[model samples]
Target: MTLDCFCGGVRVTTVKKPEFLHACNCDLCRKSGARWGYFDPSEAAIDGQTSSYRRHDKPEPAVDVHFCPKCGSTTHFRLTERAASTFGDTMMGVNMALSDQADLVGVELRYPDGMAWSGEGAFGYTRESRILGPDG
Candidate 1:
């Protein structure tokens, strides 16, 4: 599926639906208003110009969040150079909020407690997971 930013200045094309979408309640994710769909960098293709931000709150942030320079819409995220060196740049996350509700029907939505996460291992969920419906 292909998704575009508000101004269509940035686009992301995914080869397949994400296994699940993460509705995280972390400082960055909350402020950015992004519902993350994780994929291998190879599973998705990104087009167009973007500006990116790496978190300053952490001494070594894991990913660099990218947004459309024209519309200021959060687009996708890639591993930071430091993070890539340690973890290998195998994963990327697209902001699924860019997708139409109908396009994500039946997609599982998971709520991860990012705020409480230690950034080391699995995190507890703030709530149970649910599948998106036509109305969502």
Candidate 2:
């Protein structure tokens, strides 16, 4: 699947279809309004220029959320060393809203309460569709 940012400044191409898509209800996610498809950076080719942001309070390792500066659209996110160690590989949260070629059938769609992730791991997640997974 190939995705283009609102301003066409960012582009991402996935070698294979994503297995999981997430709809998170956290402060950042809620405001951004993007459903995310998760994949290892190795699974996709992400090209383009984007601006990044990260919360300072209790930040996620070196995770950086990136967006198209021109369109102000959230495009993707990348994790740093710490998150990579815990999560196995560096994963990118590709914004599904930006892509028109994504094939989501049978893919697991998840609703996670990112606002209250207990660290014991998502105790408040619901498998909303055939599309969200931890298989990443």
Candidate 3:
């Protein structure tokens, strides 16, 4: 699948299927405005100019989040090692927010543990799960 930023500056084309899909509650994630679809290292082909941000001092080498260089829209993310594993491959993470037909993706939202923020009142686990599906 191919994911493009709202403004179409950054685009990620991956052949690997996402290992898991979830909605993160970390403050950074919330700020970036992304719903994550975590893929295995081997299943992704990421391109475009993605800037990095290391907030909250994550011990895991910096999560390289990519954004649209032209419009400043957050696009995608990958672990340093995971990005390296692709070595020019293709992967997919359809950003629901920007997707014209996001509902077709059938992605269920999941709560990833260890986030810096919480969705206490924003949403509930069961509600999100039902929307995202069992794989989320």
Candidate 4:
């Protein structure tokens, strides 16, 4: 599936469905309004140019959030250099909200407690997870 920015200036194509989607309340995810779907860099392809932002609040921010320069819509994010060195380039996040709602059927949506995450391990859920139905 391909997800495009609001202006269609940037596109992210995924070869397979995400294992799950995260509705996180982390400062960055919340403020950016991104519903994240994870993928390996090799599993997806990104096209077009984008501006990116990396949080300075944390001593070592993890991802560099990218957005379409033409429309300011969040597109996708990659691990920062520091983070990549530690975690490798195995995962990235694509903004699932950019895709057609119909494309998300049967996908699991999880509410992770990103705010409480210590940045070293798996996240706990803040709310129960749900599977998207056809109606979405």
Candidate 5:
């Protein structure tokens, strides 16, 4: 799959289908207006010089959000060494806003409560979402 930011400054390519598609209600995610798709670093590739925002809320396992330089659209994310160790070394998060909505028509979405994510707790999933298009 190939996707790009609004102004086309950032581009992403996924070699394999996403293992998980999430619609997180985290502060940052809510503001950015993007759904997420989880994949291995080797499975997806991002091409661009994007600006990144590192969440300072958590000390370890940094989750860096990367946005397009031109349109400032959140495109993807990169996990730091600590995060890689905490999760998987190769895990990456892709923002679905990079792709056309039609392309995501049939994909299922998982709702996660990232706003309350804690070190001692696991993410609380709220619900499942499905794309409802003309076909439906």
Candidate 6:
């Protein structure tokens, strides 16, 4: 599967289906203004100019996040422990906002309630779709 950014500045091709898909309520995650989906890193075939940023509270040893250098659009992320696990090492968290084909992904949106979320996550879609239909 190929995930392309809405601006066409970033693209990620992966061979494995995402292990799980959910939205986060972390401050930075919300501020980034993206809907979230995660995948196994081994399944990802990444190419393009990207830079990684890390969080101070990452549970894993290292959480490398990839983003488009040009537009500063976050694309994906990888965790250190997940990278060494036999169960398809490496985990990638994708920014749903970057995807142009979000609806086709069949992503089951989630709203993490533990932390403070800026705007509604997948809930926004439900409201929007109700008002504008799937075309929205």
Best candidate according to lDDT: 1
Cα deviation at 120, candidate 3, in Å, is 21
Best by TM-score: 1
lDDT string, candidate 4, 1-136, tens digits: 9999998899999998888999999999999999999999998899999999999988999999999989999989999988899889889999999988899999999999999999887999998999998776
The local distance difference test score of model 4 is: 0.93
Q: Which is the winner by lDDT between candidate 1 and candidate 2?
A: 1
2 or 6: which has the higher TM-score?
Answer: 2
Return whichever of 2 and 3 wins on lDDT: 2
Off by over 4 Å in 4: none
Candidate 6 lDDT over 1-136, as tens digits, reads 7777656677887664443445555666676766656666566666777888776664543457678888778788776555456335545677756545544354445556525433334333212111112442
Question: What's model 5's lDDT at 92?
Answer: 74
Q: Write down the lDDT that model 2 would get.
A: 0.75
**Better candidate number, 1 or 3, judged by lDDT:** 1
lDDT of each: 0.95, 0.75, 0.56, 0.93, 0.79, 0.60
- Please give the TM-score that candidate 1 achieves against the real structure: 0.98
Q: What is the TM-score of each candidate against the true structure?
A: 0.98, 0.80, 0.63, 0.96, 0.85, 0.65
Q: What would the per-residue lDDT of candidate 2 be over residues 36-130, giving only the tens digit for each residue? A: 88887888777888888886766454567888888989988888668778876767888886766335555767788787874464448744445
| Pairs that clash in candidate 5 | none
Q: Model 1 residue 33 lDDT?
A: 95
Flag regions of model 1 displaced more than 4 Å. none
Error of 6 at 100 (Å): 2.6
On the 0 to 100 scale, the lDDT of residue 50 in model 5 is 94
